[model samples]
Target: MEGTSFLKEPVGGKSVVGKIVDNITNAIINGELKPGDKIPTEGELSEAMGVGRNSVREAIKILEAYGVVHIKRAEGTFVSQEYDSKMLYPILYGIILQKDSTNQIVDLRKVIDVGILHLAVAKLAAQEMPAHRLSRIEEALERLKVEILSPEPQVKNVHDADVAFHMAIVDLTGNTMLQGICNYVDKITRRSRMMAMDQIISEGAVEKFLEMHQKLADLLKTCDSSQISQIVEEHYQYWANVKE
Candidate 1:
């Protein structure tokens, strides 16, 4: 565990893995290593951080589990920007072990969602959805259907599709800043939802959420702002029930 600390100042008996995880997480969050950027190699990281290669490897393993970085054989490791939102495995476990609840994340989502919903509805276009954009929604909806129908749904993938569905909605606005903000929230919200729903929530919970996302996608395709508002209102009622 030599030099395994965040600052390499020789910390206490806490898990070296945890410290390394924090350091790498901070790097990504602070934009020191932006998405699509390549991170230093395992050997380089070990030397730079003054930690053992094993310790650096273990840290990267934790990050890899969170979808924070992608490892390529013979190529190298690259930062994954679309992580957790794209996949939630070890992250789901880590959050759950902390005794956090999905409802809490849902609450946060409610705040961000309300604003996004309003903007999306107001920006709907009758025929302006580019093929690529429409394709995103369609794929997301298709994935949603599969999740809802499958008894043992792949919740993470379904959730990914859910984000994709909403991303298409925000993309409709053609606002780069708005889209980026929406994506940031999506990443943040996902960590919580996967922890709560995928790990600690009900068995068929994903199916229900998949159903909700499907309905939203269907409404989005209609390209009607008024309908979007109505659809979201009805959809939110389910969220209310979920709490009780």
Candidate 2:
């Protein structure tokens, strides 16, 4: 209301709180509001948008809960300045609630993973990966290999190892936003991923499963992204099959 006019009157058809959330979100996205910028106080927003202070309060609470904004006791509410993994919870839970989201989750994971790999490759080209970092990834991979190849593997152990192995690769990329996205997508697809790994081992395809993990590890070492698509696709085959 003072100088920033992005907060306008809420239109009809949606809940007042929802519209307020939308207006504020759009403002942040369009650069009318920026990170660390304090949004208008509740009284100002209420007066400017012709909405009740209660509605503005509710909307701000929701946004804060989602990590879209942070409130300081005396300072006022400001756009979050850094990546918050909580921002992804809505998407994660939305996918979880969908009737048939396994395919979508699998595809999402593949795309994120492939992108992460490419980022890792580019990082590798620019600077030598720390020996300790590569060792940690290989350690996770080794754990997966051992768990999957055991005479009688525990599903939980294998699943945890599988997740750790891939997450290690994601962490290697050193991008917080990608890490947050990958972490949530992993959560959304957890059940299906575990089931897929279980079936792969049961069907004597453990070798292929292990090989895919090996190839993923090798890709970081080679700094080659040409085959990333194929490798990631193959990595998700079991999960895709289970979802089908």
Candidate 3:
């Protein structure tokens, strides 16, 4: 905090409290403040930020609410230990508020799926995982197979199974942040995916899609990154080509 200096007065129509929040956030981002490191006291922040104490307090409150910081009763405020799922709410909310298109959602899902596949493959290859670690993925794939083979398969059932398959891969990545983001995207795009499933089922492509998912599941067990990449590409590309 030694190099950190007083913040400039609020400008450009930004609220005073908003300016304080930005200053504290910038300090954290710039490594002037680090996780678990207590921030300046309200009086010190108010003086350094050139804002009223109430303004500084309000800024801290906002940060705490966003899970950006935490307040200790007897101790001072500190940056959050690590950003958790709560931090994703604001960005997810913004995306929903902007009314992103279905195509955009599909694109986002494709990106997340690709990243998850890559990381999962790498982790599986590099680490010594338990034999049963990927049981969830196998179980999900089995459920998908059953759903697709059912005489009267519901589109909703297939979609849920499909999501479960990909989510299992995301969970394999061992990165909590990426898992949280993918979870958020998956939840929001559930309806859009159901629509896509309807189209795929209508086109008589449900079996083909299920085959691709099975291939992905098989390749994951091999821990062959190249094969996994090929299967993942084929899986996502098939959906990309599906007419919306």
lDDT of 2 by residue, 1-244 (tens): 5557676645457988999998998899989899999999999998888889999999999999999999999999999998899998887888777877888778778888888899888877788556468888889988988898899998889998988988899888888888888877877677887888779878999888888889999988888899999999988888898954
The TM-score measured for candidate 3 stands at 0.83
| Local distance difference test, each candidate | 0.62, 0.86, 0.77
Clashes of each: 0, 0, 0
Ranking by TM-score: 2, 3, 1
What range of 10 consecutive residues in model 1 has the weakest lDDT sum?
2-11
lDDT of 3 by residue, 1-244 (tens): 4666535434235888877888888878888888998888998877766668888889889899889999899898989988678788877777776654555656666767777777777777877455477899889989988987788889899888888888888888778898889888878877767777777777788778878887777767887667655666677654555444
Instruction: Kindly indicate the candidate among 1 and 2 with the higher TM-score.
Output: 2
Residue-wise lDDT of candidate 1 within 1-244, one digit each (tens)?
Answer: 3332334434236776677677776767776768987777778776766678888898788778667888989888888856354244453345434544445445445655666655555555543445456667777677667754566666586567667767876776676656655676566556544444454225555555556666676655665445554555555554334432
Write down the lDDT that model 1 would get.
0.62
Which pairs clash (backbone N, Cα, C closer than 3 Å) in model 2?
none
Q: Pick the candidate with the highest lDDT.
A: 2
Enumerate residue pairs that collide in model 1. none
- Comparing 2 with 3 on TM-score, the higher-scoring candidate is 2
The TM-scores of all predictions, comma-separated, are 0.48, 0.93, 0.83
